[model samples]
Target: MNTNRPIRRALVSVYDKDGIEVLAEAFKRQGTEVVSTGSTARRLGELGVKVTEVEKVTGFPESLGGRVKTLDPHIHAGILADMTNPDQAKELKRLGIKPFDMVVVNLYPFADTVRSGAGESDVIEKIDIGGPSMIRAAAKNSASVAVITDPEDYQLAAQRVDSGEGFTLDERRCLAAKAFARTASYDATITEWTSKHWAKPGTINVPPVNADESNDATNAAKTTAPADNPQFPPTFTRTWERAHTLRYGENPHQQACLYADGLDRDGFAHAEQLNGKPMSYNNYVDADAAWRAVWDFAPQIAVAVCKHNNPCGLAIGETVAEAHLKAHACDPMSAYGGVIAANSTVTLEMAQNVRPIFTEVIVAPDYEPEALELLKTKKKNLRILRVANRPHTRTQFRQIDGGVLVQSIDRIDAEGDDSANWQLVSGDPADRATLKDLAFAWRAIRCVKSNAILLAHDQATVGIGMGQVNRVDSCHLAVERANTLADGENRAKGSVAASDAFFPFADGAEALIDAGVKAIVQPGGSIRDQEVIDAAQTHGTTMYLTHTRHFFH
Candidate 1:
């Protein structure tokens, strides 16, 4: 079969007209016949390029508010015809239908329209019918027809035309793959939006049970099956556009690429990189973890230094610089080469403090001009990103062996901050200052991995121990780091500790108390809760039960 096919006759229709003039110029230079639809015909005409309209080729004017133009057999036959086949070529001649050697088309901005909060009717109208049909038809016959779906590829298509070589078989196949991906993502977006808007509670029909058979089994099955389209639908489809290929994944040996959800949302995916090299997989993972950690202490200037997707140091202060200083003090050894995130703007003072440190990435809502300049000049390898303050997605997804686990994000609610709701289970009640430190530790602990233990003083973590198999080991690790890493004093002395979950045994609470933790907070639902409470009382450590576990696995 012939692989090289020249773009002698082409069909062009697009909603985004960026770089279309290049293709038009190529068509004119190559003396190629162009058939365009609706505004595209006018656009090419305005560019001083002569073009035949779709109505002239199809002998049918566009109807249904410009939705029925390209759906005709005339357009699809021209696109899909295998001209190399002698019989197909003769049929095209018999019908007086000119085959299209190339199809340049881009679909309507349905995703963008839906994201813009447009009305239902307006969004429905934005879903392209003929556009996908033409794209798919041309792509299916990629050996004979070249399909262009992105404006970025228009220049390449034009260059191929100008070179008079058209597209190679390899190039055509690549373009076809991209075209199919575009249509697939478009359909996925439409499916997601429509499901949310149109889905209703549906009932399942059950066969009548025999009089001797048990009705209890049937009743249980009915209750287990979803009666309505809840958060988890029967079918789930999500689409992500490839942002760029990363240098590597978590390891240098693995290949990886970044994908974005194609939404105008505030997140690390949409963050603006102000300076430094491209981010790595580990950098992004740790940066996002750090960002979420700091933001959990919202309305206050907070900072978090994360390593291996775990918060190593976290703190709140009057200023971002102060917060960084205190947070860095929490485990300076671990903060080295870590990703840092600030809830407030990064100041010059903070940049100066961070300059000496070999940090991987630093992300904040914004950065002072001078701070950004300093980092750009000094830290050439450090990734500096500016994100916006907004609520993150409520749902979180984690992949398991065969399927994904979906759950609501463990957001630190107002109750976490309110010590009033906490029960003073053991020892005396904490004072306002001690209660404030307890609250900070509680909020910060949510970012730690279970079994997690955090020791904090003056709104700053003194030590963090996480991802241990046993809670007792985590408590000991936290205290050991706090005392051994302190500059001149025992950092755990008079400090408060927070556990992500209840202590299954008294040994965990005893370890924290023995390390000089003055106060402790935990969910407190273990069967041995009384034993842990008694241990805390014996050490005169004030322990509060939140009755809410924040186990991050």
Candidate 2:
């Protein structure tokens, strides 16, 4: 690679004008001429930089409503010529095309255009055929050219070009990878739009093309089997960027990376490291996992304390600061180094109460200026981020072996009326505390996997036993653990119970009654609802029936 040859001429086209003037001046200082088209040339001229208009090279006016300006071989040949190939070198010289030593181009705002509610006709017209074409050409001839994409990368590119290195081989390779990723993301967006909106459902699913598990099959070159079938099939094309690097995996030796979707407009993807240090791998995974569990509630203040991806303590409070104090108090020993996410703005008082703890991460929608300043001073490396609520239209996504799994927002847990649809044969109308406990239990049950049991006290979950095989056993686990986790409060004693699904027999409710639970809440749709209600009434417990069943798995 000729790293020392000065850039004689460069093709420049971009949607973003940021830092372009500084770059143009640097290129001119290095004796490299800047050639651009349309708004780019005009913007450069306005900034007092010497820029050659596209008409000078293409010998054509900026015509057809500015659409046919830069799509010329005179421009592309300058970008795409191979200095290594004798034929390519000779043709470029014979055609009077100066090989473009650099290409500074960024595509049109295709992603943002769609996001702004533009129609397909309007959005499709904004796709830049020339910008990406120029980028690919420069990237393909990286042996003698430089490609710059992000405005953030302009400084590095300027530094390299001034230092007379013309971008090291490694930097060139990295730019090529980024360029391909940009184009691929554009293509994927188009594919998803075509498949979901333009074509009917089930149009893309076909039988497996190859019974292979290699990386090539993972790519979308061939259509595979139908989703949900037993045969391994690569489905949706995942587009995610690294969220952060963790200290380690669940075990120390394992490696992990946190990734956000390509089109993440807000929330965790845009979480800013305000004052403190970088986040660890576990901190990110646990913090986000806890945030997901808590964002289901309303905009009110809720505190979720997570230890190793499980909730050691969770509480909803009157204020963000109060929630922090109460949630931390749930099990201070367990909350020592856990990740805490609040469903509201974190205040200074909350930060003061939590800053002293040896926790790894603290995340919220926004933080008070004083709160961040104080916390940053105390904990020089605590990862504090501002992403208090779920982004608009949040979707839960996961990867399973050969394919991806996506589901609804997971917050839609309640769906029907208890008084009209549920059958109850037991005690009288439940009291206020009983209803609140039922709501708490409902919320807790949705967090648990199917066949789960949740017990609560004072509108706070005391014990949650999830993913059990038998209903009775799950009930027993929740009941037993509540006594220990609840710190002898005895919520089960004269307290309420809520089940995610209806009890098939009287035994499930009986298990709680034996533990001194005085009330019950459930969907109450089972054929044995009479028996369950009889057991509840006989046990002197008021049972409220919410018709909605939250069977999460």
Candidate 3:
């Protein structure tokens, strides 16, 4: 296994012919027999590179619309023959099959076809079948066969063959592993496409969302499908392509990497870095949290400052600059080095307002010229991201000890209209001015962590309490922070409160009322809802029941 094996017989078939001519020439110079199929063989012949056709190797012309060329046992036996086994060598010799010492192949562009919005028949025709089979057979016999799928590896293979030193077993095995991964990803893509577009009316082919699923090594790396349909289908296959590697995970000692669903836009997966150092693993997480929060309240000039995947402060203002200032002021200490994101473009004034803050990352739809210039000059190492727009993605996933917990993304409708979906439950109906503030608070609270309470005034978040054990504590924490920020001005006196879920007890409502919170909005589903409403009525605090709980745990 340690010895180098010379490449004698090579098969080269590819849909991407970018750098294959040089590779084929290198193989020819090494005296290797270059075999190919259909267009590839014709293209190589036109390039003055000699190549043996599949029909010549298999003794049968390609049929079934050129799909049955390489399915013969002769070609597969040649690719799969083991050089180290005497029996396999004797069998290949008896069958008159010339063993393939190398295989260079790239599959058809099924993914690209799907992306091109091609017809179903066109997309299906683009699925490469024999190509994957040849790659797999050669890869499995890596001890004797050198499998190469990526063109980037052509130079290294050529150098080895031309050096007269031959290909190393380790190189073969490495390429074999990559070949397997490539085929697996390809098949997974086809499976996903077919399941989505060509499945029977009653059948689905997705993995079931189960909390008690095993942490099997085979399922270590998972893919997230659309949460709109989370049922386990008849056929389930999952694969992901790595986006990038980060220096470390949440902690410095842990390892981490990023992956995407292959969509080119719509989320942070394809975010463009205008300026700054490379993003950390945690930076991606925090940036996603902030960006999603901003879009959750879209069309409003909103800003959300996030730390550790939870919104510390979020607000809506007349301008993005004012929004950033208000959101940052909610918890300046926590926002010191947090991630800041906005739903709209960041203007020059907004950049100036954020200049003093020691922010780690800033993300927005776009940046004005002055804003980009000022931020880039002020903080040479700050990570800035422009996502351009927010695309609707349905699925959300969280990895646990052994499995992934999959669910639908929280989408709040009727966020702007309080009277439409909310009921006046206690005290008095909110006035137009109070209702406007309550709407702002409701949208902001949706992004906070579980047991969340947000105190908002003047259409901006003043204080937020999140990740608490109980609702009462969160209420108290929000009011206390608001009072502290006021520093004697009594900011909470005319402020409104938004709760992520129903308060189980009346004490939570009482806590906000005692702090001079004039109005409150929350999902009402608790058995003690009447008691809570009575508490609000006793304190003369206006309360509305949204009947929609946004619990982000």
TM-score against truth, every candidate: 0.86, 0.72, 0.87
RMSD of candidate 2 to the truth, in angstroms, is: 6.9
Residue by residue across 399-494, what tens digits does model 2's lDDT show?
799857765555643454333344455677666667666666666566556687776666556666667788888888777777765467665576
Better of 1 and 2 by lDDT: 1
Pairs of residues at least 3 apart in sequence or in different chains that clash in candidate 2 = 243-258, 245-281, 246-280, 246-281, 247-281, 364-388, 365-388, 418-547
Clashing residue pairs for model 1: none
Order of quality (TM-score): 3, 1, 2
Tens-place lDDT per residue, model 3, 183-240, is: 9999988877776676455554545657686776534534433333434443447666
Clashes of each: 0, 8, 1
Better of 1 and 3 by TM-score: 3
Better of 1 and 3 by lDDT: 1
lDDT string for model 1 (232-273, tens) is 566668787788799999899999998876644556787888
Q: Model 2, residue 466: what's the lDDT?
A: 61
Clashes, model 2: 8
Model 2: weakest 10-residue lDDT segment is: 224-233
